[model samples]
Target: MKLKTSFIQLPLLFDAQRLLAEINALDASCWRDHPQKFPGNFALPLISVEGDPANDGVAGPMRPTPYLEHCPYLMQVLEKIGAVWGRSRLMKLSGHAEVKPHVDLNYYWRERVRVHVPVVTQPAVRFICGDEEVNMKAGECWLFDTWRMHRVINDAAAERIHLVADTVGSERFWNTVDRGRDPFAGSVTENWHPETFSGLASPSPPRLTYESVNFPDVMTPWELREHLLFLLDDTRPHEQLARVRQIASRFITVWQEIWAAHGDAPHAWPIYREKLDAFEQQIHRFAGELKFNSNMSFIEGMNGLIFIGALGDRRQPTATQGMRRAS
Candidate 1:
């Protein structure tokens, strides 16, 4: 189902008072630098890698931290959020701090939807997603598409704390959403899955120069493709996948049209080819980086998947294989 709004409030609610007391009991010093830098605060990892939380900077296997084991109350609350939670943590932002506007661009982002359960918040704290904004209160559970431009700003005099967890939407989670507003209901469009690519005409050979363009309003085409696939991976029911598949198919097929124009206009294609190659390379490098984060196999599977295969030759080496081989 297409999302009806920018944010969706889950049907469940929690005891804000108990959650706050439990969060406060955890050792504040344990929080370390969040990879996002988060404007200017640390994160208390509830779930993450097996190694030292001080060292790990990204997502990995669903490892439970010492802190998680310590707070039975908080642990019970996380369990209520969903059945499968990955790379979760208690994020704390200092008063008056703010996270810069950005999108989560990796394969993990495409595969997970982050759920927020606020433990401590005030009216001054605000979250902005695309054109809309909300002041999420304590004990509230909310979610938004992270692939879109979103950020948080805590203007309150006190710190802002939240229980942030990721999930590949399960029946329970979708049930919660369906109870209120269904976000994943839609049929795939035909144009999104292009006509077969069997006998397309060949274009003339051309010189190549690499250059990139910047767009301030949203993510580039490459980002959108990954995001689309991620959404497809997380969503439930087989039919919803078709809508994402069609959109992805259209995106890559359009590039083929531009690539075929190289015979008539060689100069621009070479430059664009360079940029596209660089973007594909970046995807590989990112996949390699996630190897230690316990995401090596997850990313590897994406290559064989139909959604990414829509790009035809434009697709890069699967993140796990070629990039790791290069390293």
Candidate 2:
């Protein structure tokens, strides 16, 4: 999601050593290559679809994998964040590796904010977002704008690892974010103090909230309108902007009318699909060459957010056809 700044350091800290101990105890076989197979990038699932460690899909009910059930301190780390979690993992960047610069246009990411807790990292590992870059130290909590183009580079000889989690955020989480400081905001942390997790072992299991409904069977008209407005507002100036807006306005009007008539009933699926298909063709015709400020194509966002997910399954595109994985 977009933020007021490229990065926000939350007013919380964790026991990096204790977190690392839990990480170390885990078997090496659990780590998997990046879903896109970015060289030298790997991950170990903490939460995933149906609690299956091998599943990287963003849709379906999210649940904790066995990997999470055995780690007390990691659970404590998550609890302190105070948010309903989505797919999460321990992201590892091998020495000398880098995460290529890219913006996350996935529909799942359009609403969710990714949280980063640096469990193991070096000063030389720099996270670059837009015009700014920062070396997130171990145990520090942070959030970044996924909508902006960003990347990570590890110049150090040793590997770097971080606990990366996602959430739509909760009331408490937003409150915490309100208290957070942007790293570029000029010594904002001088007066602000942070709460630290001591990493004491838990006596019982931690009960955490997980997402049960992420994608929609048929998106509500209000939400679809909101997304359309957001995209139009974010589009960079282009010769086609005026015509695209006209098309979008007409499409939204038709969608709202259909929603009034059928309201996501199974019988309405065909109508919804037909309108969605028409909209897709119109959008691609006018806005295919247009791009967001983040350099992602506007059609990519439309496909990811509306075409594939707005009304249950349409035929899915190949990995190369739509938005690529952000992490």
Candidate 3:
């Protein structure tokens, strides 16, 4: 409802003409060519532009570019938020395109608050933050705790553009973020010890197994698919397939590790192998059903081939042929 913090307006304003020019110059074709990056039925690539405010080696996640570079209006707005938080890049979403509801997990949760300035919008574009729906107007700014559940949707026929920026938090908030840091770098395994595996030493216990995990009652299948598409869109099909394989591979590794630690029972190896086999077959079946014809399709095929090679079953042809076919 009420965002954790109140939003303040910045003095900087962007040249709409320049902003439109830049958006037009971008290679929208790249996203379309590689459908795998952005998948699902509704997720479509409108445009993406990059700018460097911190001049860090990596491009920060997508946001408006014009406002970040030269919008004096935005800079003044950030000044009100506090001195520590500076203006980051801004990203504009065109047409009725909308970003799925997601938490800013990578950043902003600690002490940073996200600010949104609606540069151009129609009534159909709604910004949902928690339970509150805010209809932004041109030149108006709002500071919100984006760490909570939030999403933007454009149901309007016209394009909706907003200047999204990130600012630093108060000293107390920064301290909380610092305290939550992972002491063992980014890997949870580093903190794991032999004693942590003690629970697996006991005989295998029955656990719930299902073909798929359903979404919570609050979300319908279409809504869930929309959210997934937002995540999947932007990569080639092969990339999506690779990502899926990577997840499966990690699961297999964990299973192997458990078996190594406590697989003395007669049923352990057979059961584990059977589960892996079933998973592999299921993924292959999904790949076949995707009807991949675009680059995304080819990528998915490559992932399937990789799985086939990794399993080293005689039924699958050699990696050489698989590679040839994928190419």
Output the lDDT of residue 276, model 3.
Answer: 50
| Clashing residue pairs for model 1 | 1-183, 1-184, 1-185, 60-293, 110-230, 188-243, 192-246
TM-score of 2: 0.96
| 1-327 per-residue lDDT for model 2 (tens digits) | 888899999999999999899989999998999888899899999999899998888888999999998789899888888899998999999999999888878778889999999988999999999999999999999999998989999999899999999999999999999999888877756788778878656698677899988888889989998888888898999999999999989988999999999898989999998889999999988998888888789998888777876888564422233466555
| Model 2 bad stretches (over 4 Å) | 315-322
Each candidate structure's TM-score, on Cα atoms with residue i matched to residue i, is: 0.57, 0.96, 0.36
Clashing residue pairs, candidate 2? none
Tens digits of lDDT, candidate 3, 130-234: 555666666554555443456777787676655544445555434433333222233733443211111122243222111111112122223323423432342
RMSD per candidate (Å) reads: 18.6, 1.6, 20.0
Error of 1 at 66 (Å): 0.8
Model 1, residue 167: distance off in Å is: 0.9
The predicted structure with the larger lDDT, 1 or 3, is 1
lDDT tens string, model 1, 124-173?
99888767788877776778756455778888789888888766666776
